[model samples]
Target: MRHVISLLIENESGALSRVSGLFSARGYNIESLTVAPTEDLSMSRMTIVTTGSDDIIEQITKQLNKLVEVVKVVDISEAAHIERELMLVKVRATGKDREEIKRTADIFRAHIIDVTDASYVVELTGNQGKLDAFIGAIDPALILETVRSGVCGIGRGDRVLKV
Candidate 1:
């Protein structure tokens, strides 16, 4: 099964490296990884996506929690949360293709952030599936170059996961 591991860690240098090394040492694969400074710049959060058996997932969480630099670790895959990712998609579209591109973007609610004679840069933020569908719809007429921000999530309702 695929799992999402959300980690809150000290914003000090080498901290991310240590956490990443743990996965590397165990030969686990990271499908997606994103790190950003939290509201408190003294800390940062990382969301890592990996696939493994339940037992292996449990072990990964336990070991990650034990790391000194990790202030909090949560297996958000099992939590009730609102997860989002941001993507910037640059699509190569010329005059004839521009209309089609705009229509496609409207369907996805993606906004055109930049445009040139040769391309349109669209910014999209949503769950993974929405992004995938948006890209699929425009791919035929436009060549794509993409940059994606890994998952950022928040818990649901009155419950909160605090560091």
Candidate 2:
């Protein structure tokens, strides 16, 4: 099964390394990771996406708690949550291809952030599946480059991850 684990940890050097190292040492594969400083400034929120069995997920939670720098860890996947990913794709654009790409971008509600005589850079944000669908809709030969920001997630309603 897939899980979205959120962690509140000290915003200190090596904190990220240690957390990631733990997963690596245990042979757990992290599909995506996003970390950023929180409002407190002294702490950071990290969202990690991984897949494992119930036993494996339980073990992961316990091991994460063992880290001294970790303030709290929650498997947001257990509750109502929201997740998003950002992707930027540069595509070859010329003549009819340019018009078609523009129409596709509009249909996806993506922005044409940059444009030139030979290419167009489209910025898109949505769930992984939505992003994948956009890519699938485009011709492979037209794709020049792609950059994706890993998943970022948060719990819904009054459910907040705090110290």
Candidate 3:
């Protein structure tokens, strides 16, 4: 099953490498990873998306705790959580196709952040499905490029990953 693991780690060089190395050493696959400095300058928050059975996830969590830089680890996917991903798509937009693209973007509540005579860069933020649907709505031939920020997730309500 897919698991979203959140971690609080020391905001120091090599911290990320070590964490990723652990997963690589174990031959596990990481679907997505997002890390950034937290409110506390000394620490960072890392969100990793991976798929494994319950036992495998539990084992991975335990191994993560052994890392010197890791202060906290939580499988936020175990309960109610909120997840979002950002996607920027550059599409050919001209003639009749331009209006159709605009309509599609509006329907998806996405913004046209950049535009030129022949192309538009649409910025969108939402869960994976929503972003995927937007891409699916557009003609593949018109898609010039696409970039996505991997899943960033946090537990809902009282659940929190912090020092």
Candidate 4:
């Protein structure tokens, strides 16, 4: 199953490398990873997305705890949580296609952040499904480029990951 593992780690050089190294050395695959400094400047928060069975996830969590920089680890997917990803798509937008693209973006509630004579850059934020659906709605031939920010997740009410 897919898991969203959040970690609080010391915000220092090589901290991210060590965490990623652990997964690499263990032959585990990380589908997506997002890391940034938290409110506490001394620490950073990392959200990792991966697929594995319950046993595998348990093993990954235990190994993560062993890392010196990893202050705490939690599989937020275990309980109620909220997850979002940001995607930016550049698509051909001219003639009739331009109007169609604008309509499609409005339907998805995405913003046309940038526009030119021949293309537009659409910014969207939502769950993976919603983003994927938007991509599906657009014609592949019209798509110029796409960029997505990996999943960022947090536990629901009362559940939190902290040092």
Give lDDT tens digits, candidate 3, residues 51-78.
Answer: 9988899999999999999999999999
Residue pairs clashing, model 3: none
Ranking by lDDT: 2, 3, 4, 1
The segments of candidate 1 whose C-alpha lies over 4 angstroms from its true place after superposition are: none
**lDDT comparing candidate 3 with the true structure:** 0.96
- lDDT per residue for candidate 2 within 111-135, as digits (tens), equals 9999999999999999999999999
TM-score between candidate 1 and the true structure: 0.94
Where model 4 places Cα greater than 4 Å from the true spot, the runs are: none
Alpha carbon lDDT of each predicted model: 0.86, 0.96, 0.96, 0.95
* TM-score-best of 1 and 4: 4
lDDT tens digits, residue span 1-163, model 4: 9999999999999999998998999988799999999999999999999988888899999999999889999999999999999999999998999999999999999999999999999999999999999999999999999999999999999997876
What lDDT, from 0 to 1, does candidate 4 have?
Answer: 0.95
- Return the lDDT, model 3, position 76: 94
What is candidate 4's TM-score against the reference?
A: 0.98
What value does the lDDT take at residue 30 in candidate 3?
96
Ranking according to TM-score, highest score first:
3, 4, 2, 1
User: What does candidate 3 score on TM?
Assistant: 0.98
Candidate 1 lDDT: 0.86
Off by over 4 Å in 2: none
